[model samples]
Target: MKDKRDFRLEIASIESAGDYVRDILKQYKCTDRDMVRAQLFTEETMVYWTETANEGDILQINVRKRFKTISLSLSYRGAQSNPLAISDEEEDETEFSFIGQNILIGLSTVTYSYENGYNVITFTLKEKGTNPVILIIFALAAAIICGLIVNRFAPSLGPGLSASILIPLSKAFFGLLNAIVIPFLFLSVIASIFNMENIAQMKRIFRILFSWFLGLTAMSAVIAVLAGMIYFPLQNGASTGVNEVNIWTQIAKMLFDIIPSNIFQSFLDGNTLQTIFLAVITGITMLVYKGRFPVISKVVSESNLIFSTMLDAICSLMPWVIFICIFDMLLSGDGRVLLSSIAVVVLICICFLLIVLLCLLSVALIEKQNPLQYIKTIGPVLLIALSTASSSATFAPHSMIASNKQGIRDYLANFSIPVGALFAKPFVVPVLLLMTLFVGNFYSLTFTAADVVSMVLLCVILSVAVPPVQGMGIFLFTIIFKRFTIPLEGLAMAASLFMLFDYLMTTGNVFSINISMLHTEQRLREKDKRVIVYNNQKC
Candidate 1:
């Protein structure tokens, strides 16, 4: 199959252009969806050219599939014209063009330019990486099969192989995680806070929305802790190596730790609380004097992007890490531990469902809306979130649903959804809490009430810092485990099972965010009504 192909046809012969492009895409083994998109682009270009081009004008179509990206270019000899532009002169055509433009933008990158007496419209779609869910599933299956084979046929090789290969690989992965933990954590928190503060005009709505975000997250944390303790009870007095301390004393120590006396030492020590504190104060200062510290703001934002990119690159190696870690666990005959991880995944799923249901119920009671109908309206978007495990992919559809179907104010919907996407991760608390308990049980470690309090608080804060990157959630477990003294071994098992939790997390996160928008709108309406009544009385 050729990587590039070109077709030349008259403006009138649009169907031929579509056929040629479709055939070329087929040769490249593009998915049916991609073929459909390509065909649509060809048809759209033809329609646009037919309207604006000379009848005998030649349309040049170039279809190229290069290195996981598919590019389609349609060049026609004409004045500069954007095929996607919607003109209001023709109302019906405008509507059609508007919808067509959104469809093209959703499926691919669309650009228009004049190139040497020809108007060129190009569409490019990057083939997405193998779904992390599918890859991790395959990795788990392969690890189990290979581990059983080694254990049964050559038990003597297990320890030597694990020590020689597996442990080192596992350590290397964690080392990468540890390397980014401090900077990623600090910069992401600062970025989140700084971005939140950057929205100064929305300060009024921000107060209400911010409160709702934290309040709902805190509620989720409580639900997570209670659900974990109730559903998964640990053995009696199974804890080892933890000291008995007064609950008040533990609480005081946790509070005092948040204020770092030495920020440098805190960063070196990986003190999450102190670092978070530093980020908060710094973010607030930047927000207060944003004009004076423009350079500082840019540096924080750029540094965050750099570390986030690094973290994402590290996460791309997760399938291999999952395979190595799970294989290591099975080689040592820790089949029971593997089973425990599956149970934790199930628990996390249930917790997410509970959170979503509770949120919908609240929306129903407070907003006087139909929960079932709301779900039906947003069901497609939720499915998109689940399948992609990406908030970025779901944002457009979700925002459309919020504004068009859910009747949320456009400004509120747009603002709240993006904010929620970045910082409001209500679903993450459950996964963190439940996984913390699983690791604690696996290691026979116990937490006092104070420890649980600290865990919940930290989870809520860390949840804010959890980057909206698919499969990147597992790396946060590196920080979480280190903070509470949980064994790092649990991280490997959690990484293997994170794919399942991630799907649920993203879906629930999307759902909870929509609910927050609805609730925020409702509260604002009530506030407006109260203001109206007060004004009337004054008059």
Candidate 2:
């Protein structure tokens, strides 16, 4: 006889367990009479043991085999504890056999237990690849397609529609151009002035400025000479046709006309040179009387602020204006002919980019910096300029890189970049000079030594005078050289070509100026004892 305990066993597949039990019973030769004293086990016991079992939990089974009588007992034991006993009636063959077989077969029973914790799902994957080379190629192709499509198809759409589109867009771009111009100029000039406040500072400033001017002049001279030599006006047949006006007389008129009759009228007429002169005078006056007339100085400061704010508001429209300008230019169908003349355009752009690269290398060498590193540092701004074709638009990014990454002082970058934007006419001066010389020679018009000097002088002067604004320089050049029979219409012809090259040249100029200024500053900081030495006697 065996004691019975209150327990229950639940089996989901009782038939399978029963079949397994019968086979084991047969092997043991146990009949109903022999198993009559044996205990029956339920599925609940098997589940409970498996669910509560830890890695070291163990099961103890007792089997009694006899010819006419059989008995079995089951119990559980932990590694550190004594085994718990079970009654003979509580020992069930089906439950014990099922669980024991699963343990032997290495079947796993998973029981989820959550304590105070969070479950986080993690995924492991492979790294992704980036193809910058392919991206750049695609971008270039897209730009070309855009240019071609706009140039070829926009004109057929008509002017009234084009104007409606372009005017607002141009105004928006022009607004953006306008907005930043004043603040950029004001901050830049003030920063420059502050940097060069003392005599020592001024000496260093002038030294750097002189070196920059010298380098620029050298580059301009080299390009001018090379371009002039390559595209000699004589290559085109000379015209002996009588002129409407004498060359000397025309030159005289140009000289007089440059000195504006009324300053206000100059601004109204968008005379950039005149406006620059006036602005410089005003800036100087403000500086001279800053402390003595505080009220006036305050007014000047406020005016600068006002101008900056206005300019910022205006510049907000720049992208729109640029789009419109591009759209209108393309829509006019002028670019169609220009596209057909792709060889000339490409040749000119390649030559210009070459010159620009050469000049940049020169600056990098002079500064003892890695040229490629410098190029990479300024790469983004250069790309922007390449796409936008406007140095004015690129100035913000250029200044930022110059100041932050290149370790140039904000004051120096702000001042040098904007002033450089205005004065560094790398493409404009060289191309205009080359074209003028070429045209003058083509007409068999023999220029005097004085006339040649005058042309160079004009190029230098206008280059400095032109503000960093689109169409401003071109318009000024046309007005100034109209009397010289330089064919103002040629400006229109060159404008398309100029847009492509301007990006490279402007980027080059900005980069060169930043490096030059950095070098100058470092030299000054390192050699605190040396006064600035000038090789040329010129101021």
Candidate 3:
């Protein structure tokens, strides 16, 4: 594919670049929407290059299509003028340019690198198949029909057809997603912690980090409160739970289990936080002894290969897993509840994007960078994040987006991305609070302002403490449900009902991590330059 589309054209002939790119899109027979987007992408890349190229430089562009994505590459030998890099004086820009906001942030993804003497900019256009979406719709529609049939015929069928068949199948497939969750968490956390560069960068960025998070956390909580007001209407009905549960025992058990008695047993029992505890200890030990034992460090560095292979295999079956999960849920005769719950969950998720965009654009304006372009290169990372709902799993993809696409310095990218993967939960608290409120209404539980504040504070603390594995949001919410005296029994139903929103929340987490990494690195770089100049003047 690389050799097939190789071309050499003089700078004078660069006007035809978009036409050349359009031909490739035509050959692939992409949708009209995608074709127009690709054309726009090519035009932007051309403008960036043509404005910055030197007198003797030549422009070489390549067009490649793989699976469902198209990569349009523009390589030119020239003096490096990275359009993405803004000057220190420009850092004070109070407004972000929205000209290519969509392409930058979401419409398409663009990455730039300097190789040898050539500047190579690659644009990735992700095509969503209407066919697959339609198929998904059909699967959902099929679930509804199967549900109606099963509910109507339960009297005639002994033990029920769905009970004997579909339910088990659905649980089995869904369980596969959870198979790699713990190991992936352990490997990623351990590997990230042992990397000394990560620690050093964390120290440099620590001061601003808290304030940044504090702002995002407050915004998330505010968003949840507003969303609750709109969606969680007060209902007068019988209380959902009879209040028979003991709160202290549940709290003590959850706290005590965080430190497992046996690490091996914890893995066997799928204890996420306990596994995280063991991994953190191991990572710190490895870091301390890395100089003395090179062999240990070497082996740990290679461990990601094992987990990556496993995740790829498991996540490949995700579409089918989702289909089965939805089918089984419908088959249980709660189709009406499940569908409505999904709609509400989806609304809060849609609202989450606003908060993410607000954070990203705000950072971009202050830093003098384009938010659209920043978000664009991060598309692959966010896509993987959404699919896995595990930052640990998406670490590899995020690393690539950071170094190759976004041009984050190697040390900072390695450090900040993993740290973000582990500790970042910008949207988790708000979304979880919204879920609590939404589900609370079903149980006729009205949340006061104090309850909201306590919930948000707990969420902020828990998001950082928990292993960034799947289902952990609901796990935290379950504890909060107990604390707020909301009845522990309704927790499972809330988890089941609002599972889909977790994917969106995780995606937002990774997205903000990338943005935060960019902002932090830029500030540190500028700070270093200032110190150097100050020392020079004193000398």
Largest TM-score belongs to which candidate? 1
RMSD, one per candidate, in order: 8.1, 31.6, 11.7
- How do the predictions measure up, each by TM-score? 0.75, 0.44, 0.50
| Candidate 2 lDDT by residue in tens digits, 153-244 | 66455577566765565445434443344334433344223212221333545467557755665576566656555554322212333333
lDDT tens readout by residue for model 1, 1-539: 13443444445477777788888777666655556666777887778677776656677777766666567888877787766544445554244334433443332145566668888877765444566778888988999999999999999999999999999988988887888888887887776656443355446777888787887798899888787767665333334446456557767888898998887999999998888889888878877886476567657766775676577678878878888988998888777887767777777777777777888889789988798888898899899988867665665687788878877776676567656776678888887777877877777776766677677778887787555554456767787889988877678676665666777777888887877788888888898999999999999
**lDDT at residue 333 of model 3 (Cα atoms):** 44
- lDDT, candidate 1, equals 0.73
Order of the predicted models by lDDT, top scorer first: 1, 3, 2
Q: Candidate 3, which ten residues in sequence have the lowest lDDT sum? A: 91-100
Let me know the TM-score candidate 3 reaches against the reference structure.
0.50
* Poorly placed runs, candidate 1 (over 4 Å): 1-127, 232-241, 291-295
Instruction: Give per-candidate clash totals.
Output: 0, 25, 4
**What's the candidate order when arranged by decreasing TM-score?**
1, 3, 2
User: Top model by lDDT, which number?
Assistant: 1
Model 3 agreement with the true structure over 1-539: per-residue lDDT tens digits: 54234333444554476677677777776655456556655565555566666555566667776666567777777777554333333321110221212212222144456669777766555444443334445555666676567667763452465578655665564455455566766776666555432233235565555456556767776777677666766322233443322444434554576798987998887666577788889888876665577566555644543554455454344445445555555555445555466766676767787797788777678777677776677777788777756565565567677778766766555555555655667777766777677667655677544445545656665576554533454456554665566644344345544454566777888777776777776777889899999999999
